[model samples]
Target: MAGNSDPLSPRAKLAVTAGKAVAAASRAAGRGSGSVIGGRVALKLDPDLLARLAQNLDCVLVSATNGKTTTTRLIAEALRAAGPVVSNALGANMPAGITSALAGGSESKFGVIEVDEKYLAGVARDTDPKCIALLNLSRDQLDRAAETRMLAENWREGLAGSKAVIVANADDPLVVWAASSSPNVIWVAAGQMWKDDAWSCPSCGGVMQRPGDDWFCGECGFRRPTPSWALSGDHVLDPHGSAWPIHLQLPGRANKANAASSAAVAAVFGVPPQVALERMYQVQAVAGRYDVVQFEGRDLRLLLAKNPAGWLETFSLIDPPPTPVILSVNARGADGTDTSWLWDVDYTRLTGHPICVVGDRKLDLAVRLEVANQQFQVCENLDQAVQLCPPGRIEVIANYTAFQDLRRRVGN
Candidate 1:
């Protein structure tokens, strides 16, 4: 069990060294995205760098339209009970990000990776992970991700021939269908709050019957698989019908489901359920998802809402009677160029609440909120928007690029 006893081939070793040098230079130059650049250089030199580095490691791959980053962090923390764990905690989820994380943590025996939904299959195929956690799949970055169903199909095809044990959300038809073919699977009723993307059966193309929390297809009789783990309130029920209380510093029921999924993945590796849940409670924030930072003389709770589903879950986390909330949007490459998804969100939920829209696409959000008959103001800058809020702690929900910018500004 000595550290990375197998040395890389000379060529691959040189690639890693050069990539590290570039990463150092990029960091010194104040480029925060050095991981991507360094990984790109290493992969360009050695196409199979990720596979080589991942060899002989117990790896867990996590993917979903949302919650993948937080879930990955939770699983990584839980796995620390076993030994050292390497993960992409910086939100670099693509192949380059995975490569960067693996290269940096070469000595670690365990890896927990947050694979982008689009790159799940490719990364899984390369890493040959021992376990794969498939969280709920919903529409995200319509312009970039295309469609939810198509991505699920891609995942089904990509995971072919793999012997990995699959941990999947049973409530989501798309997740169920995508993972059905896997030989070994652990199902968890992690709860799916957004159902627009899963209204129809992915298999029979028939209308699904969602009576209470369970769903079934009327046409093909495809129904929700019996779950080995179920979330009841704040407790996760094990197969033996015992409940384990989950305490997390992160807010929302969505995070509870995330913790349940992480605990299931930990079980696959023989980590006790209580141990997994205990380790997860230690995680205060994943990147900057739920960190309260001082900004513009007000405490701002940073929440990331990239799609309609994300918005729905994030809105539920807002305190009732609605405190002042700042909504920021951006149509940058990472945020997806299509701002039309704004119309898909049920902004009506915020009916009597005070909202201030900011970011480059603030006008678009203004129109959406206005059409919903919600009261909101438009601000050109995030600081001005924060200033408009009534004193005390304010909730700030933002899309990808805007969220990153605010996190950088808050120095979180």
Candidate 2:
């Protein structure tokens, strides 16, 4: 295996060594937070480590309320046609994680980073990315991120001075408003399945008009921008009106939209549309979004849904009726302490389905399901929950920490 022996100044070299040692110790101690600590130590030692490592590389920074990790994986996979790409694939999306990824993969010629929504501007300013892909913005980590509109404002101010090309989602009014000021922008009509966050105009606080998939602000005169790249069913339409079929191993309309956004970013890097789509099909699982794993003698398909918007999209992918589903929730730091978002999800859609609630927040989920009149049993233990599931393939949808815990328990 290659070691992290990159050429750097004395202090940075020392910092890298210290960070790697810390990460190694953390892993040895069986702590899953090694990446987080390692990155923090590296940043503490050399504040400019991320920028220094990303200096001459063609970098693509992806940020959004959701789909950032999967989208980053898609973009990184497609960029293989160009050269070696370094990315933070471990789901650690902050500056520290990006630093660790770039510092560790020092030999790579390109960088594809999954940045947190709040840190996008700082990372972009530091790395001077070649392109920025702005996916949909929505309510996520309310305790930490506060509000979606505030994040949009931060992004708008941050990217205003950037010279990088912006690939933004036109279906989302917040994204449209954020990227509208960029000198070079490519609008993509990636479908937004959740519209609760974008109900009002970010510019003037007017109730947005939504007729089918098209949306416009009646008061501010803001509307969805015409997309240069769009997804029509399973086909991707190019800038010249030519359509190409996309086949992905990942499921959900959201993943298809992610593929479209990735293809647009790949185009900015001079990659052919066909090549980008081909590369995307090779990705079966991202981090742990969609993966079939064997747990307690049952084949469990893992789906991670962090918030209400995420749960809404994930619930759509579940097979209705007869198919048994496991829903898990946790109130850990990574999963967000407040579980109030549970009320926002439309659990009524699963009224007739066989549902099993599991995890620390299983009671909270059960309460929501009961209020929606959905019949479900509480199973705090995932192993027991799998055993109780109906005879057939079982699907497990879990929030942040719940998903990670299950993944670790199942040895995935």
Candidate 3:
């Protein structure tokens, strides 16, 4: 009984270490811990963390290849409007990280977490969430995740239960097929949310046909419907090209999906659709994700692009390219370690403007830019890249490592 302590003690321990471990895990990621192989050692060292989550009344877990952080933040904010809500806002989606956030927080009506796909099943088993949101599956960190199909298989097996409601991205064939058999499930679609590419039938492996601007699986005919609460318009409407006339707060099309997905889950919980949208737009962008920082005399937009799909979406949102772009790329072992994914990104959009590429893979980025037919200025350092660019409002597209570097230099 000495170590058994209280039933909730494990949860409390997880909460206490959630913030600290994220900080440490982030720092020590590539150093060891075997993060490169999708095998996480952090959760193993902390056994009671999962048990602690099982004690919560209502818990919501968000998992996907993209938009997890932004969408999760939006969900937390929506819940906060009604009352206090606790979350792991620092982009730590792993089991221990989620447990830490929950255990650390005081009592509340609901628990919202943005979980990582690699750890989703484990998190779900331990947390016993009232609901779980599977955003979308995509090819990401091939070195660690292996492939999207493999991860999907793991998700299907792990999510077999009736304790939670499954909210999924209808636009994604993989997610649609994965959740089709789930009894307690609700599906939401972006419905022309942006230029999406993940449309196909997971069941038949045929090209998922697009009914309208949106997509569906033709072979299986398992087309997910758009959530009744999705935002639709003649156009996304960007009055201000450079500075954002309407001020989305969260830049790009991907953020739109994040916001919409967040809204969908909140709505399912009885939060009004209008209320969810209002809270989503009103919420400030999560720090370092797609935050716009005002530096000395210049304004800098910080957009994080950790994978091919993410980078493509970020590129789409740039509108008229920056007079000069500051691009930062890094493939630290902690962040998938392998930079080969860059090869999959269609960097050709940069051909219209000159880019100042920075980060650990500066040279490779430059090579990519050139191959994409983009004109760029290669800088050995991120700070220097930011420096060489014109002052007033610089657009910075950075990955995980580059984001860290930009934060250090910009005092973020």
Q: Give the Cα lDDT of each candidate.
A: 0.90, 0.88, 0.67
- Candidate that scores best on lDDT: 1
lDDT of 2 by residue, 253-312 (tens): 999899999999999888988999998998999887799887766788999999888888
With a 3 Å backbone cut-off (N, CA, C), the pairs that clash in candidate 2 are none
How do all the candidates rank in terms of TM-score, highest first?
1, 2, 3
lDDT of 1 by residue, 265-373 (tens): 9998889899999999999987888999887778899999999999999999987655888899999998899999999999988876788988989889999988999
Ranking by lDDT: 1, 2, 3
Over 4 Å off, model 1: 1-5
Per-residue accuracy of model 3 over 1-412 as CA lDDT, tens digit each = 0122245565445444554555456557654222211213334545665555446546788888878888788888778767668787877667655655565555566778888888888887877777888877777776787577677777887887646888877667677666666787766555433333455456667776765656666666666664443434312211121111122467666677666667667766777555666677776667576667876566787888788878878887774755567888888875677778777888887766558887888887777777777778888776676677677767788888778779878877
What is the TM-score of each predicted model, taking all chains together? Answer: 0.97, 0.96, 0.83
Comparing candidate 1 with candidate 2, which one achieves the higher lDDT? 1
Top candidate, metric TM-score: 1
Q: In model 3, which residue pairs have backbone atoms overlapping below 3 Å?
A: 14-100, 15-100, 15-104, 200-208, 299-393
Using TM-score as the measure, name the better of candidate 2 and candidate 3: 2
